[model samples]
Target: MSANKAVGIATVVMVLCAWAYIALSREPRLPTSIANGRYSNGCCGTIFLHDGVMTVANQRVDYIIERDKAGPYVLPTAYVGASVHAVVVKFDAYPLKLRLDDAAHPHQLELLDDAADGVRYSFTRVNGS
Candidate 1:
């Protein structure tokens, strides 16, 4: 093949590789198995779960949870209660199948896991009900 043709082919290949990387390496979305929302146990305080980041009292911790699986999983950065495993448990008669607990009692929240600050948190929601 002509040298110029070879170079053109190489460029095309490089571009294709880059496109594939950008497309495939994009971060996965928070699993559908988890509801996205703001949760509060009232006394325990409030937490926001969105886009794979858990914000507790305004401090954000990036995390990943595989769909329908439990975690001893690692977060993207260090978080107070980094050591925890999570699974989506079914709760009764609630639209949020992945929610921490029954939403009927707004004052109550369950501490599915403990973070570095020693606070119990249940994060994995996109918005409030």
Candidate 2:
């Protein structure tokens, strides 16, 4: 192949490789809550697991206050115990409880903000009936 053609093919291959890597490695971006749901800020976010189903929530209001005094934001956490009843996982799938909280530790706001890719809410489940 000519020098120009070889260079062109190499460029195309590189682009294709990049695209494939992004498509395969990218995590799914899901909403933190349902519309009009009663959620306090910084409480709701996505739950990733090694097994079981993936889920998201808009409950649990642990917001991160930035050091620069910008604003607070929600972070996602796994729904366990009674809190699971409040959350509504997307696609009408019930969020099966994977475990229970052993201690009364405050939610980790900073981790949620840094890890969450979208807006956060207060709890995973909606309020009221």
Taking all chains together, each candidate's TM-score versus the true structure is 0.36, 0.30
TM-score of 1: 0.36
| Candidate 1 ranges beyond 4 A from true positions | 1-33, 67-77, 80-128
> Residue by residue across 29-95, what tens digits does model 2's lDDT show?
2233212123222333344321222333533322111111222222223322223223343333322
What is the overall TM-score of model 2 with all chains considered together?
0.30
Among all candidates shown, the one with the greatest lDDT: 1
Candidate 1 residues 1-129, lDDT tens each? Answer: 999999999999999999999888734444522534566443345555566776665566555533223322323334333124432222231222222343222222345333336434554322344
Query: What is the clash tally of candidate 2?
Result: 14
Listed per candidate, the RMSD to the true structure in angstroms reads 11.9, 13.6
